[model samples]
Target: MTKEMDVTEKIIELLHELEHCTDSEQKQKIEEMNEIVDGMDEEEFESFFTLKLFNKTDKMIEEEKISMESVFLLLKSVGQHKVLMHSQSYAFHSSSLNKRFEQMIIEEEKKKEERNEKLLIDLCECTVLLSNEISSELLSIIVTCLLKVALKKDENEETQKEVEIALLALSYIEICKSVKQEWYLNEIKEIIKYHQEHHNLTHLAYQSAWQFLMNRFHFNKSLDEVIENELHFSRDATKELEALIKCVDWKRGKGEEKRKKKNKEELFLFRWLQTLGIFFFHWRLRNEECVGLISSVVQVFRASKDDNREISDKCIFCMGCAAENRVVENEDLLKIGAVDLILEEMQGPTLDNYFLERHMKCLFEDFRRLKNAEDYKNEEVKRKATKRKVFDKMEEEGFEDCIIGLCHYICLGEFRYFSLFENYPEYFVYL
Candidate 1:
């Protein structure tokens, strides 16, 4: 039988060579060390290191005898490698690693859906603690694996919050040290940005069970997407909201009641207008900036053929909202013909003009004209067949009002290729 001293001596030698070991050689040594160390008792494992050195070091730490540099190094050595992507134990002894232990975290988190977030919360705490204390190399592996778990759209909201908290903790810690500070800070920020942008992120956790699975999946598609909804609020829906969130704010203040009630729908239209002003003002040369502008700052860019069209879906909702709430008090906005423009766009094969006109009249605002409302109808018979049935009926039922609105809309708006508003003339917000 191999003596414990022999194993101890071998581990000590490999550990001592940590600084000079090449990657392949270091991996080989670690594998060998794992073979011996795997079965060792705590006492035997401790024997592998210099006892006097550990004792003196522990005593110094206990007695506050160590310098700051020493403490930091101690943290970097062990804590830094909090979790590796593939644990050597898991890689080597696949059987012992077992479905039981590996599935425990995932299964526990799965059951947490709609129940309680305890397990997911604990996972977050563990991940964050590791992030703060682990070695950079090991932390990278852990973070990448955890991100795969955390960013999954199917993941529970609790799990997402957990990830956010973990990133927040890392962000805070990175704000502390100098050596590992910048790298760590950037990593956490990127993760946060990814979650904010991605639709596929929560797929691992949420799957098909989430209510937001279809409608609210990923985040707001765009500013207009929500505005078109009579109910959903626009991200640029409010001054305060626009400054904070980057995604479309479709559900801003979703369940909240009014302080004094001044037509939530109309007020939301103002939010939409404010956003329009913003995007138009921010229009510039930078590509990303242009997208941000139309999506949040200016609404016109929604029509500007570009990428991220799904994101621009919010513009439809906002337009619908504005069309729904065409109040006389907002004549200045009406003069811009936002509703008229939106209605014209909706006149295609897929659009239900009758529904639009019905909703349009719900606003109680005076519409300017309908002289060109039919122009929006497509020439394709098959395309217009379904839409005409709905729109033509609307013309029959409320023909006078729809025509009035259309006329008012066209005459009211001071047509311009792009809005002249400086706040969001035609560009990205000054982010």
Candidate 2:
């Protein structure tokens, strides 16, 4: 009781001091108050927050007695405390405060006052910190405000920085149920489209935002639902993929040099392929639609061939996913010479990249299975016929000898087949 009383009394004194403190002193007082708050037990914290600190800070901000900086510091400190963050008092106060920040952001967008940038950033950070605690309604308001500032047609560096922060904040927050409105979905997608179309946005910031939108859209719902809910989602996804291909300089490093580190564009492209892989796996493109899309993916695979193994592998992985679509077949992919490209990569002299090899093999299997699906209408005979047809095709292409040689290499441990051991331990046991 004595300790709690001492802490509460000290916090009260600091709050009083804040009403009169200079700019420099404000940080010190807030930091001291945070330190005092940090020392309190849960019961003491609940008591202090409900009875004293919440009303005090709200009153101070209402009266304009404390600077925005002081409010941010206090809120930052409160957000850091687990008990305080989960409390009803904190949620109510944060929602109220966020509304003020949302309005200020709108006003500041028109004003473009450099001085207010830091405050805007702090407010966004607050949104990020308390994201899991706040209602989705409040979250959407702040997001709408941030997007308003971000989607401005002008190429202002300060605006870019603000949008970057907003993107980072979006990346941090989980998608809540309430924010699943169509406009919200479109707003998020617009960020991705904007980044693809505009050179003004920073690559790293917009990439994070793109990833956030893709992740939530793909993971949070069933594929059928995703396709049904969004307007022209399939067309938009295809366009986004094509736009990314154009954005990349596929000629970097002659397509043969091992990249010690991927640049921003490389990272972005890699992520693009990964998300699209997820997209393709769940959603099947129409037969008419498959041509252009598969052609684009095949182009990426061909361009990346012999250049970046990681990207080449992703390209193959994506194609493998695409191959699983009912409309996509050995013919569509082969018509684009995708099968031949995979065979070329597989037969490359430097086939030491395990993932690249594995992906190529998986794609071959996808092609084989898809082809067999077209050939064998009887379900009982399809499995047996598929194997015979695969061997027959291999023999016709003089790949039978190659398969024997690969088997020997696997038995001799000349290849990195740890994946095989983990996935099919019986094969290694037989070896």
Candidate 3:
């Protein structure tokens, strides 16, 4: 026989023996086979290992010839590329793999065994790779399993890894357009609270929580409302926000090296800021809390404007929303210097289109309110002065004429020129 045929026959023989072997013997034989496969070069590995092992996974599972543990090891060895390539055709083609994963989760719960927990964690990692293939029902099952692992009271390194992986999986599933039932909402909240309390898991928890909230917001607005309302008044949320604000190293030291070191924390802080902004829009904050939130957001907006566009954009949106909602009144906004900071951005050279549009909307609304007062530009000169400060800044920055020209165009019924300002009706009356 040819050497290739001989090798194939020997592999087949080993598989046959693996089926009849004891657990110990099967493990030894599987390890030896895995070693042999692992030693092959990339091309050879694809032909012999990937095609032979994973492609036949269903048949092996049906015949009870290979354990899930073995399959997981093989998947890890082959890496993500091959797995994702075959995922749709092999791993996700049938319901069997999902059922097996569910069964593993059930077994772990009943036994509370570390080995089973580890296995489930490994499977959870695999799910992250196969997220695009996960169905709604399967996604729910995986989420429940991961949450159970994450909520464990154990505080060991292994337990933390489990929590990290679980949160990672939830984050992935959250972005997959997964369906979340109402019953799962409370558990998700608890997960968020628990991870928020754990120092090491805070980022992961918040990321997962944000994803969950956003997914729910997309699917069912009321469910998101429930979670947001519950979280808005929670001590945990308040503490987390405070902690996030404190973590910011405000000193923009000399050199790119220092700035790079701070970028990670800054990114996390921005994400937290974005989440808070969304929550603020939904839940009414007390005056003090609202002011504090605005102050932090404005600080970020100022710091990020020149260096980070993403954060700068998010901060501006948050500020504009706060202004529009009157979360803090015009007087309060000026007290905290929010209006001044916003005017500075509006007059800056690098103005974002979205930011300018929203800022103008805020200015239009404030101006219209001032103009519509009973004392119309007479005794209300102070309010007019306060309002004109924004336009005054614009004029100083050479943007006043542009604003006036746009206003005149809109007044003359040239609607196409101001389509971007369509959302703000106040602009028509005031500007």
Candidate 4:
């Protein structure tokens, strides 16, 4: 341990002396320091990793010898130093990595907007690569830093574009650690203050900002305030909010193309919608008018069924609740085809239809709540166009009897509602 301590002191001395040392001395000392840092001295683990010397920081900005362009190589070589980076004594300045980044960006802010895009791309890649190892406190340090740069209040067109990309990329951090609390409304509210000064970021900032608010706020704010702000939002913000509201309102199995594309994105976005949905349903949007949002969720669950089983099942179960909501509110999601899509996905073998066989009672039982048969007997509801629409689109592709059975179902009344008796006798078809 003494030997390691002596060796580290020597390295620090060599680093400081590099300014005055001759070429030979500098080269030899640098190599010697590298060897010691990388050496297998057991007690040197914290020393080697921390690299904090004479109250200096490990963040490259503090090291005058290293330039911004070389930060990547330095971080890659020196790596993270928990003791040095997080130690209160040798901490990064309030600006930290972000300050240095903005300094570099300021030189190019007016010249080109996309210039800093590569840095954002790199930050996202590194975040994904290191999410597991780095402390959240340290990660939040990075996040706060990036937010400052990408969200610069006086940003011009070029900077706004770069910040937008940065917003999209930074969202990859999936875990919140014990050491760090999630940055919520305050972070967003701070960004909103920037909008009046530089409106170009209104659209891009709003995408992530509204998403953040949706995840964080939901019904916590007054419903009238939420809706009024939504209705009068900076046009771009309104679009994003509507998209979010649509998602929160998802029922069970609504959209086709979207549900089918449920990739890694579906895993998180649907979860966001689910959590936010619960918040609103339980808090602000209690009236029946708000029951319409389930259509979006149903579509997501139906589409993303292949990505996650547990989440999909939960979504299907949610559909039962939404159905109940519709009944209680005298809102007919089925009339708008929310129920019909669920029924179609339910009858099929998609993984998202977990509640299909299980929750039939809950779904159909909503019917008992209707005051009169006419509530469920609208011409379009009785017509049931989804089945016919599918058959017609597939007709040219050649499913003669399938089309016939569909047509028969369309024309037949309560006496012969299904096809088993008529179409299957000539030829049996198994689902």
Candidate 5:
């Protein structure tokens, strides 16, 4: 046989021997297994570990040759073999192995044994290593179990650890784009509602909700039903606005000294904003609510301008969407100084070219509409003044200046490529 075939045969032999060996003898055999694994090249190593080891475990579970607890222990023991753990071979079987382990956890949860719960928690923690391999169906199962553990009432230190690990796992699983199971959505809603009511889990709960929304938006699923039906964004506008503002305010700390720790909170907050912008772009709101939302988002954009360009860009896009909603008029935007805020933000070095183009297009359209409205008003004034022998052109002059100013901003530098100016030379010359 070739060297590779020989190695494979040897590994299979060792695996069978280790399975039959007593617990004490198994330790020495595991050490020998590790030694054998360490000697193989990358491809052979992955093949032996994933295909051989994983398949053996599957057989052991199916045959009742080993308890789930014992199998978990065996996996843990082999995981200590650094070569196996880090190899692409391990990654090859990680999803299947994780799916099996998660299934075991779900089964164990029905028993509600503290030991089993602890094992489940440990297994959940270990799954992070293989998170990228987790499939959508497996992710749904994992999230369902983790949410149960997170919501468990046990307040002991160990239980608290379990809850923390479960939350972490939920966070990782929450971002899976392919997870479209409605059962998962229902559980996530429960977690959000429970945490929103209970002060202790509020932050973790919101984090989970944020991730779920992001995943939903990524898959192009509609969130309007969820927001309107479950979240009650319209019924509880003030409370929801406050919560959103709190999320927006979670900024990364300034300075190199304070930057050692990750800004995960801020990162999650931006993700929440992005999810909202994508899925709820045209959500209707009252005038007062619109003002609050617009103001808070603008502040977030300004704060993120220098530190996080992506967040700033997303904020601008979301705000532009909000502006388009019929509930938020240009007059309301002007009253709140939104136009000035947008203008200032646009001038910043961090503004992206695409978003800047979008911003200018919006402004050009709004100004052009306003100019037309003023022309109609001026025509009425002219007709009345001609009959009454009076004249007035002041408002028309001011309107023309406003249109010219907007055109100037639009035509500046690279923005001159805007199709509006190209399509209508009359508007440009009137400037």
Candidate 6:
């Protein structure tokens, strides 16, 4: 017999022995199989996975000759082998085998059978490792099955692991093809809603799923084409942005609460806002949609100040980016209460030079744009009235003095406003 044939037979034999092997022996047998697969040349690796392994596993599963544990171990061992994964045959083998594996998952889901978590994870890992090489059709099937597992709502350790792997897989999927379909876009929307609404999804799973959708729409090339085609994602993005803004309870407490560190949920909310901030910075939405997004970001900036400096810093940064991006409308500035928030932040007791300067620059830019946008001939009266209101508010809030004090530091070429404020008793707030 040929050497390749000999290796294939030995692999199949080990898989059979793995079925009934003791837990103690299973690891040894799996290692032995890994050693063989790891040693195969490109052609042998391709032939073994494409021609030998799938047929053996299919028959073994059909005859109940393999335990789920054994099947998963075998599949994981073979699928993760360096030689096989790097082989030219990877695309064909991954697509065909993933399709077959997806069918079994579908059947199990239909029967409501409790699946092995390792099996699902291994299945997902092997497929995702295919990267952009795997067929979009096969990816859709796998993603559909995994989402079904996640939405099953079993609410246990098993469900958490399932959802975690599912989200991890989603994060790795290349957006080249699947995102073009309407149904796939709807699925993305549904998953976003589910993450925001459901408390059962653990932080890891929640973050994974959010990071996936965030990256897909925020950074992927597919999103460029989607936007170029005028596909509607702004509404969904805006809704989620609104939910993120409203979810934080910044008024929950003060003095004593200030001593306590942020809880996991609070931390996740603030961090995800940072992620969304990056998304909004790059995403181009219509003027009306930009209106809602900027409004929400300003709300977070206003309320994130109670006790959490980190949250406050993040929200402040987001607001600055929103303003810098010109998403903040001059007419809507006062209506959205951003101007008031800025003045409040400038006058507030706690002062970080960087954040204070950011708020100042945003307000300055807004005022600058407001002045430039007024039509000198026709809107002269309206411009004077609006300018009077803004200047009057600035004077009432001592914002002019704040600006003068800030300018003093600027003129001195000093970047450390806190130290400058320390010597000026009027500007200093001693903790």
Best TM-score among the predictions, by candidate number = 3
TM-score of 2: 0.52
Ranking by lDDT: 2, 6, 3, 5, 4, 1
Off by over 4 Å in 6: 1-161, 168-210, 216-253, 257-260, 374-385, 416-431
Model 4 misplaced regions, further than 4 Å: 1-146, 153-158, 169-187, 190-205, 217-284, 287-292, 296-330, 349-431
Is candidate 1 or 3 superior in TM-score?
A: 3
The candidate 5 region of ten consecutive residues with least summed lDDT is 387-396
Q: Write the per-residue lDDT of candidate 2 for residues 1-431, one digit (tens) a residue.
A: 25556776777878898888887899888888888866665555666655345556667889888987888877665654532223434543445555675566556555654546556657766655544554554565556655555565557887776666556556445534344545356666566566656766665465556545655655454434434343344454466567766777766656554444344455556656665666666665454555666677777777676566677787777777766565465555656766666655665667664754565455555544544444446653644554454445445556544444566455565556544423332222211
Candidate 3, RMSD to the unseen true structure = 9.9
What TM-score, over all chains together, does every model reach?
Answer: 0.23, 0.52, 0.59, 0.39, 0.53, 0.52
Identify the superior model by TM-score, candidate 2 or candidate 6: 2
lDDT of 3 by residue, 93-144 (tens): 2445545655665565567545565676677656554434565645555667
Superior candidate under TM-score, 2 versus 4:
2
For residues 1-431, could you state the per-residue lDDT of candidate 5 as single tens digits?
Answer: 25656666776776677667676676666566556654555456555555446756677667765555555444543442321223333452454566676676567656754446557655654554334456554555566666677776454666655565555455444343466556466666665566556534544335445555545555654665576556644333334444655655345565544332224345455545655575336565444445656666666766667666666677767666665543455555555555666555445555555766666554444344334444346466543433222112213234344445455555664563566455434444322
Colliding pairs, model 5 = 46-89
Better by TM-score, candidate 2 or 1: 2
**Could you give candidate 1's per-residue lDDT for residues 148-264 as a string of tens digits?**
444444456666654443332232222222223222333333443444456333321221111111122223234222222321222212332344333434444346652222222
- Stretches of candidate 2 off by over 4 Å are 1-161, 168-183, 189-210, 223-264, 284-287, 325-327, 371-397, 409-431
Error of 3 at 355 (Å): 4.8
Candidate 6 lDDT over residue span 145-213, tens digit each: 555555645578877766666665565455344444443556655655665566667654555555555
lDDT of each: 0.35, 0.59, 0.57, 0.43, 0.53, 0.59
